[model samples]
Target: MAATALAGVALVGALVAVALGTYGRSHTPTGRPLALVIGFTDMAPMKAWLATAGVLLGLAQVLSAAWMWGRLPIRREAPHWLGQAHRWCGSLAFVLTLPVAYHCLWSLGFGTDSPRTVLHSVFGCAFYGVFASKMLALRTKRLPGWLLPAAGGLLFALLVGAWATASLWYFTQPGVPLK
Candidate 1:
C-alpha cells in the first residue's frame, strides 16, 4: 500500500512536473498567475531549478497525504517503508519549499508589497517550520504536541487570509487618492 501511495505521488509529481516544466520553459500568459509564469521564466537557472523543485516537493507532500489517508493499505502493512517514504517526502518537501517560498517572497513582490504577501510569507514559514519539527519529532520519537496542529491551522488560516486579500484587492479603501 505504501509503495502504491509513493508510486501515486511519484506519478502525480511527474505530471505536475511536466506541466511546471513546460510552463517554466515557456512562461506563457496563463491568466491564473502572472507571477508564477514570470517567476518561472525570468530568473533563468533559478527559475528552472525552482520549477523542478516545486514538482518534486509537491510529489513528496502528495504522497505523504495519500499515504496517511490510507489510500494504500499495503503501505500501512509495511510500517518501516511507509515511515521512510513519509520521512523522505517531508525532508525533500522542506528543502524544495524553501526555494519556491523564497522565489515568491524575494523574487516576486509577495514578500513586501502585497497584503496577501504577509500571510503568504508568515504562514509559509510556519508551515515549513512545523513540517520540519514533525520530521524531527518522528525521527526522534518525540513530537512536541502543539506543533503539528498549530502548523496546520496557521497554514490554512493564512491561505484563507491571503485569498481574502486577493479577492478584496479591488474593494480595499484607498489610503491616498490618485493625484
Candidate 2:
C-alpha cells in the first residue's frame, strides 16, 4: 500500500514536471512581463519582493515541520497550534508563488540563454511538481514517514533556488527600480 501511494505521488509529480516543461519550452516567450496580476508599476521588483515573502514563509514551514517531526534541536514537543501554523504558512507561500510563476512562464517561458536562467527555469518547474507530491503525500495513506519531509524539503530548496536565480539576482542588479 505504501509503495502504491508513493508511486502515485511520484507519477503525479513527474507528469506535472513534464507538462510544464513541454509547455514552457514550446511556447514562444513575449520577452516582457505579463499583466497577470497587475497593480504595480514595475513587476520585476514586485515579483522579487513576493518571492522573498514566500521564501520567508517557507522558512517558517521548515521550522514548524522540524518541530512537529521532533527533529528540532530544542527537544520540546510541538505546540498545539504548530500544525495549523505550518499548514497556513505553506498554503500562503504556495499562493504567493502563483503570480510570479504566471509572469515567468507566460512572458519569459523556459529560458536557456544563460546558466542562471536555465537553472531557474528548471527549479521553477520542479517546485510545483514537488509541491504537488508533498500535498499528495499528506493525503496518501500508509506511506513512509520520510516521504512527506523529503518532498517538502525539496520543494523549499527548489523555491530558494528559483528565488536566488531570479529574485536575488534582480535585487542585486544595478539600476533596478527598488520602489
Candidate 3:
C-alpha cells in the first residue's frame, strides 16, 4: 500500500511538472509584470513582499514540524495546538505564493534568458510538484513516518531557492524602489 501510494505521488508530481513546464515554455512572455495592488506601487515590490512573507512562514512550518516529529533540539512534546498552527502556517504560506505564481505564469512565462531566471523557473516547477506530492502524502494512510517531513523539507528548500533567485535578486539590485 505504501509503495502504491508513493508511486501515485511520483506520477502526479511528474505530470504536474511536465504540464507546467510545457505551458510555460510554449507561452509567450508579455514582457510586462502583472501589477498587483497589495499595498505596493508595482508588481515586483508586491511579489517581493509576498515571497518574503512566505519564506518566513515556511521557516515557521519547518520549526513546528520539527517539534511535532520530536526532532527539535529540546525534548518537550509538541502541544496539540501546535499541529493546528503548523497546518495553518503551511496553508497560509502556500496561499501567499499563488499571486506570485500567477504573475509568473501569466506575465513572465518560463524564462531562459539568464541563469538566475532559469534556476528560478526550475525551482518554481519543482516546488509545486513537491507541494502536490506532500498534499497527497498527507492523505495517505500507513505511510512511513519520514515521508511528510521529507516532503516538507524539500518544499521549503525549493521555495527558498525560488525566493532567493527572484525576490532576493530584485532587492539586491541598485536603486531598487521600495514601493
Candidate 4:
C-alpha cells in the first residue's frame, strides 16, 4: 500500500511537471501588487512574507509529525493537540502558497532562464501535486500507516525547494532592500 501511494505521488508530480512545462510562458504583468507593507509599494515584500510563513509552517508540520510518530526526543506519545496543530499548520501553509502560486503562474508562468528559475518552476508544480497526494492520504484509510508521513515529507521537501529557490534567491540579491 505504501509503495502504491509513493508511486501515485511520483506519477502525479511528473504529470504536473510535464503539464506546466508544456504551458506557454507569459511575461505579462499581473498588476495586482499587494498594498501597505510599512515602506514598500510593491508586491515583493508580500511575496517574501507569504513564502516565509509557508516555509515556517512547513517546518512546524515536520516537527509535529515527528512528535506524533514518536520520532521526537520525548519518550511519551504526542498529545492530541499535536495532531490538531499539525493539521492546522499544514492547511495554513497550503493556503499561503495559493496567492504566490497564482502570481507566479498568472504573471510569470514557468521559465528556464536560469538554474534557480528552473528549479523554482519545477518544484512549484510538484509542491501542489504532492500536497494533493498528502491531503488524499490524510483522508483515505486504506493507505498504509507509512504513506501519510511519506506524503507529508514529500510535500515539505517540495515546499522547501520552491521557497529556497525563489525567496532565498530574492533576499540574497544585492541592494534589493527587503522592506
For candidate 3, write residues 1-179 as lDDT tens digits. 88888889878887887778778889987867765766788899899889889999999999998898888888778999999999899999999999998888778888798999999999998889899989988898877888888889999999999999999999999998877
Residues 40-67 of candidate 4: C-alpha lDDT, one tens digit per residue = 5456766777888999999999999898
What ranking emerges by TM-score with the best candidate at the front?
Answer: 3, 2, 4, 1
Q: What is the per-residue lDDT of model 2 for residues 1-179, given as tens digits with 9 covering 90 to 100?
A: 77888899999998897788788889998878666535555888789988999999999999999999888888668999999999999999999999999888888899898999999999999999888888888888899978888888899999999999999999899888875
Residue 147 C-alpha lDDT in model 4: 73
Candidate 4's C-alpha runs over 4 A off are 1-17, 24-40
TM-score of each: 0.41, 0.94, 0.95, 0.83
Number of clashing residue pairs in every model?
A: 3, 0, 0, 0
lDDT of each: 0.44, 0.89, 0.89, 0.77
Candidate 3, superposed: residue stretches over 4 Å from native: none
> Regarding TM-score, does 2 or 3 come out ahead?
3
Error of 2 at 86 (Å): 0.5
RMSD of each: 14.4, 1.5, 1.3, 3.0
